[model samples]
Target: MQPLQNAGYDRAITVFSPDGRLFQVEYAREAVKRGTTSLGVKSDEGIVLVVDKRTSSKLVETKSIEKIFQIDDHIGAATSGLVADARSLIERARIESQVYKITYNEPIRVDNLAKKICDMKQLYTQNGGVRPFGSALIIGGIFEGESKLFETDPSGALIEYKATAIGSGRSDAMDVFEDKYEEGMSLDAAIDLALDAVYEATEGKTSAESVEIAVIEKDTEKYRKLSQEEVSSYIDQLVEKKSNDEEETESEE
Candidate 1:
């Protein structure tokens, strides 16, 4: 995909497909620039989205960059692939939220924003067969004074989930989550569950590195991204224990 040099275009740009049909393309470079897969978990405290900042051209060699983004004060979005598409969608979501607030005189809730995203996804898919690459969105915030989480797909379908995981290692992560997650858990417990999920997802795989986390709270309009130090401390004990187990296994072998 070619990057458009000029900025400030109000409408979606059209590109011709091999089948001689026209497709609408929005911001296209944001997804390719970043490396990471996005994950989200929601609880009574609010929603948390986690991303591992590792990108690999091949499955073997991984590099790190920031992949999680704060689309608004209350909502956070992350991407796995096609950084440009993710960013563009994020920007669109933000604008949509703003427009909603102005038009309706009320803050745009997570559900509303999610529908807007789904609409955009439908627009992109209908124009052509080409879909956005690895662009899954985890939308979390307080909607109508209650904490909520929603996951949106490339085609704009949205699901309200208690916890959601995406990206390459998501299946493994979900296994861990299903084994440990409980509704109405405390924030600290939720954080621990999230870390364990990441750990399990990356197990026996070298592609996972650097996790970023964020949280939202009920009655609060903003979602807060946790510090690296804070996140590391929670998982440090587990990592040490895993290291010790590995050492023991090696000695036995």
Candidate 2:
């Protein structure tokens, strides 16, 4: 017999409360916030996509937990939130890329493909009985000699960023970016910055086995995931630099 607080607006995806907010869409965003940290950084040389897998058990095979995906030869995406929901969007992105190729005889542009996915996500919010996708994506690529990075929300909003993060540790990751991100850093430098951000976000809990990285270089325009050996090398470099910086700070203090 209790009275409704939201006036029943929270019960349906299609309903909006008096405050002009969609409760279901907000809940979907909450799901993304609860997921592990994922981020993207764009530099003059290319783009880097990074994700923390946050493996909770030793027995779980790290390779089987995929958070980064290739949408086309040039475009890649890093996702946070419900993995299954992200898989559906990834599939749609791949199909969109192929369809554009068949129709226009060229690969899809990074922003265009992201818009297409956001359109699909928007459709779910307007229709009754369908819930918003509980996920967010960081899509990056090289298009026509230019680098692009985009972030998509469950409410179907899309934004372009020089460097950005999604999920639980976004604030920590973004603080690092704000301090260190440069507009035209080399691809190697961008990768270093990305590692630094993820390190802060995960509170230094990251290792090669618990992280995934992919990159699209302007020279190659190919989406490539780093191998375990490559990831390990980067992790080692990050650890060494962090140790050195701490030593310097302590000596100064």
Best-matching candidate per TM-score: 2
Q: Pick by lDDT: which candidate is best?
A: 2
Q: Write the per-residue lDDT of candidate 1 for residues 1-253, one digit (tens) a residue.
A: 4335332231344455554533333232234223244677777777777777643455643333556777667777766656666778888988998888789987787787888888887777556445543377778787766777787766456798777677666777778778888988776777667777777777733222366778776657687878757776766756776779899999999
TM-score of each: 0.74, 0.97
Model 2 poorest 10 in a row by lDDT: 1-10
State in Å the error of residue 168, model 1. Answer: 0.2
- Compared with the true structure, what per-residue lDDT tens digits does model 2 show for residues 185-212? 9989999999999999998998988889
| Model 2 global lDDT (CA atoms, 0 to 1) | 0.94
